[model samples]
Target: PPLFRRYQVNVLVDHSESKGAPVVYEDHPTYNNLIGRIEHIAQMGALVTDFNLIKPGALHRANGGYLILDARQLLLQPYAWDGLKRALRSREVRIESLSQVLSLVSTVSLEPEPIPLDVKVVLIGERLLYYLLYQLDPDFGELFKVEADFNEEIPRTPENNLLYARLIGTIARKEGLRPFDRGAVARVIEHSARMADDAEKLSIHLLSTADLLREADYWAGVAGNGVVTADDVQRAIDAQIHRADRLRELVQEEIKRGTILIDTTGERVGQVNGLSVIQLGNFAFGRPNRITARVRLGKGEVVDIEREVELGGPIHSKGVLILSGFLGARYAAERPLSLSASLVFEQSYSGVEGDSASLAELCALLSSLAEVPIRQSLAVTGSVNQHGEVQAIGGVNEKIEGFFDVCKTRGLTGEQGVIIPATNVQHLMLRQDVIEAVKAGQFHIYPVQTVDQGIELLTGIPAGERDEEGNFPEGSINQLVEARLIELAEKQRAFAAPRKEAGGEEEEIKEEEGGDERTE
Candidate 1:
């Protein structure tokens, strides 16, 4: 009970009610607001000042305790950081008017004795601001020597998970909300892992978790339920999505209206659905773009149209370059890569960023080179390396659900599914309906570890292995790509052969003409 009593904390400086040890949260830490200012009072006509004229500020109230300041807000305010630093360094909070600081005050002002600044200043900010201050301001490093790093996630062990559920219960009770049933608590923990995007970890974002619990409790009250159940939590989650999913709806509408070309069911050569995530503020969702590739005879150059026009970020460019490496290592070890290919995200006007779409791009390029058709019913999201290994990516859940929603909007064919990196399978905390569909064979999720695995899934053909001579089996995708490259090389040599003969003929005729002129 005593420990529980310790949780009963007082709110200080909440609209100027300073009780107990005053802890200040300076949201707008202006120079005058952070340090106390002097005021002028007119006594009988002339300006006069007394000890009562001195107004205390955040630093004055937070003395002998803690002063919480947002580093971003502090720096944004003019001279606020410098003034705060001076007080901390001198161990005193000074009271002075801005007019006095600027020498604009002609009348006398009260210069109160500086109070001892004994409060601990806690600067909360992102990692960038901390590093910038450490590198740019030497004073920042001297004053702020200790650094406490808070990870976004904690290990999801059984004991930790139980503790997390208990923490949620504690918050619910503190907020005067209905108790969460066992199922609701378990769902919240699972949602925590989903937010962390990891199966073995849970997010420690208490504020967000509390918000979810509060919303679930509200839904429980609306349903006249005494306790919050799993259904209430689901409703709260769905309502949150419904509230913030306007952009997602518009994107889906565009797809349905045929403005954004995405094929939910079909088979096409040199085309595949590439899944990407679009984040607007705190809300993020997945979008499917049609990535296409065209092959021609030239030097081995896979031209990324996005990168050429500076629409691709560095990671996207690197992923495309890795495709070239995969092609050379897999098919063109002995011969020059005498083929030029161009890849583009069809109908996508915005700049493309991550390599999560690289797997789809590679599939499109392979289908073009091999004359194979990729099933357009399936969409893919993954990053690839030079070794043809598929890697994990962020927003795996959104990407899968994005494609699922689109497919559901049109019609959920049994063949319509998504292929994600095998490593991302642990991150699958999908909706109940989706899980049910997968169980009923109405949808599928193929976890692929390598490019070959993904290609086999996409093309329904065996990605055959090489034999004794390091050549792929006949009619395999790799064999077809190699054969196409060899044909292009031969054609390149053939075209150059006639050019060489024509140049020789022109030189010989010029020599003959010079001799005729000499004879004349």
Candidate 2:
């Protein structure tokens, strides 16, 4: 009956066999797994337990060391977060049965003595979770105070490129893959920049980079090569696309089959091609949508059809509002905006998001107002501000490639191209085929800084600058738009004048009749 027994000591974690403090990563951090658990033996229809059955959890094993956990997984497990917090706050690990914690057991149970805890707990999760915990959980700030944020990418400078090449070499060696030659390393670095979506930065996503290396090694072996080459790396990349591009192929097929109405040639008034990216899991590709605008005389309202029907997101609505501001600030500054315009993405049934199509929408509206046809061969992507300055957007490369694939499918006209924000030119790490088409003058990528430049490029007419007299050039796109707006305003005034005159006549007649009645 003595408390100190010879057979009672349980060695849950043995550090005597190791050299340093233990670093434990609990992939599944359940409540029992995190704070230890007690086991019992059923003898003669009764449960008997002892200290020897007490098993240590991650916290117990990582005591006086470090414990790494996934924040999402830890939160997903019931009572796991509370137990971990209790251990951290009290500076000790306590073991208890789930039934006892829930008060479901009526029988007496053994409680293990609390173990002294001195360990660092690290949680790996998305930035959103960290912020959510900081805002929602009061104990989070006090417990996990230090935060280490790792950048998804690093600058692709000459020095960093060498370092990245070394990193690639290290990973290849660690993974026991074939050694990559200099060209292959260069290709990988370029691909990293592409993954980062910036030509000036390389992605630091190690898992993706490592996977690419492994796949490249497999390709090298298949090709009977001793070392991985640039071709092997490119093959690996192509294989990845081939595996995930089923949806993209189907979309392109739809476009080619005339099921989707995207024009690669000709000219149309008030219509332009707008590029959008569709992201499916790890794969993203671009598709072109036709944006069109119609204008009439009204009380200065620009209706976004997508927003009216609740198919557009807030950002898209904001972009449409910005277009109204731009129109008023530019064309209607000296007069009331008497034009009502409706903008829509033709054949779009799904919800639309992002402001990247703002520039395209504006161009279409301008074309409608000016009655100048926009070239259907050119696709557009970028966000435009009230000042008409083109702003950069994400997935620039995909947008361009998406349009290019569509154009190439229809047999590339030499006039086919894409208009993107000037700032987004730095993000153009396009596919080799697209690049080759550009180099061969079969396709084009136009980087525009302002709406005027883009409209001029699309319409093949001058986007006229205003003179000191506040008049646009006689035969320019701006002049035409201004003239049309003035005409609409004048017509609106003329239409309102008759009602005013009729009201004035009625009031005079009533006044005369009142005088006659007073005389009687």
Candidate 3:
């Protein structure tokens, strides 16, 4: 459902769940009258407070039953948790100047009507909310003992999808519309999959569904159609594009003018492609990658790399493991080695998290060590394992587009492109400019299922075949990495072993001590 519709539903559900004290407005006597001055209600040992008058204003009025709150909104309120907890524990609801915490408003002690405290409180919010609460608040376990998490999309089984389509039809009818074309329903399901962040379930989130339906309405009205059709959905998307026309216009103007460098013609040494994720609200854009690293191998197999400098995320830890694993397996498979490598997101400044850039880091490191030039055009993201497979990641679209935006702004000369996981292709819905660029042969997006594929794409050369023994060609990156790891492992063992004495100094010391003892 839409946000507003959801609010309406909550109200209906709350009332249905109870015959409680009525919802009082700010001016209602139950609320307007001072708690201390209330002789009638207070005399019954039921007193309300004004402490949380700011939020949970609904909480006080509907105190005897359920108090529904959005977890995100509650967290946004300053001291909201403490205030709510106080009210629940005191079994008293308060009305007060919302400024009690931050302002100079005097804290008013109100009548302590036992917060009947039996009302079931339901908090609706993102899944992250639960994790945040548990991680930050030690007292959370005591308060919210029971959690009922709602699924965004219900399972998209035959029965469920059929009912979901019926639900969509029901929504269309409620809008005073005729119906929807079957394909339009399928589009909704596709969108639902995107919204739910899953494939198995056909459940598109209610909020997203409501928005799409509303947008579909606008398009239907435009087309003068009695029944909303797929055309209407496409029209809505177009309408949204029009709204963003201004941004697109500026970017395109810049691209045409050649103010930015987006083409991949000038390949640089010690650099590999990577992806960056740019999140705007619930929508995200992925940009193509550029990772540059300067590396020096030392005595042990450890990759001492700072993430903030290399990948730009707040130390996700995975980045470190990735680089270490690649180095251990490829460079020094037989030994540990010390290494100093500094990797950087060549053009990134903000929007951080994840060691997803670790694969790119490894690529850069190997390129630097082998003195090979990575393809300037192909940027890569995804955490690589010891076996060199390209893993799937979130914000794939954002990372792709962010790079694309930079490249496009510079100039996509048909060969300008990025390489990502093959699984990410379905998520590709390019913006108008990007789609146009692709159509015009100005840009490209290639997906790879394996590291060899990614490396081949990035280097613009075939990654050589492995021998019968599963060894890469001697001069290949794999060989360089293996040699390095083996050297590091040997260094680690040598350092770990006890050192041999140069002149048996301990024996001389023992003899001197024995002579001293005889003299004594």
- Which model, 1 or 3, shows the larger lDDT? 1
Cα lDDT computed for each candidate against the true fold: 0.89, 0.95, 0.62
Question: What is the TM-score ranking, best to worst?
Answer: 2, 1, 3
Best by lDDT: 2
lDDT of 1 by residue, 345-411 (tens): 9887778888998899999999999999999999998999988999998898888889998999998
Off by over 4 Å in 2: 1-8, 509-520
The predicted structure with the larger lDDT, 2 or 3, is 2
Best prediction by TM-score? 2
Error of 1 at 200 (Å): 2.2
- For model 3, how does the per-residue alpha-carbon lDDT over 276-314 read when each residue is reduced to its tens digit? 665545554454545677766464333423444453445
Q: Show pairs that collide, candidate 1.
A: none
Clashes of 3: 59
lDDT for residue 55 in candidate 1, whole number 0-100: 69
TM value for model 2: 0.96
User: How close is every model to the real structure, measured as TM-score?
Assistant: 0.92, 0.96, 0.65
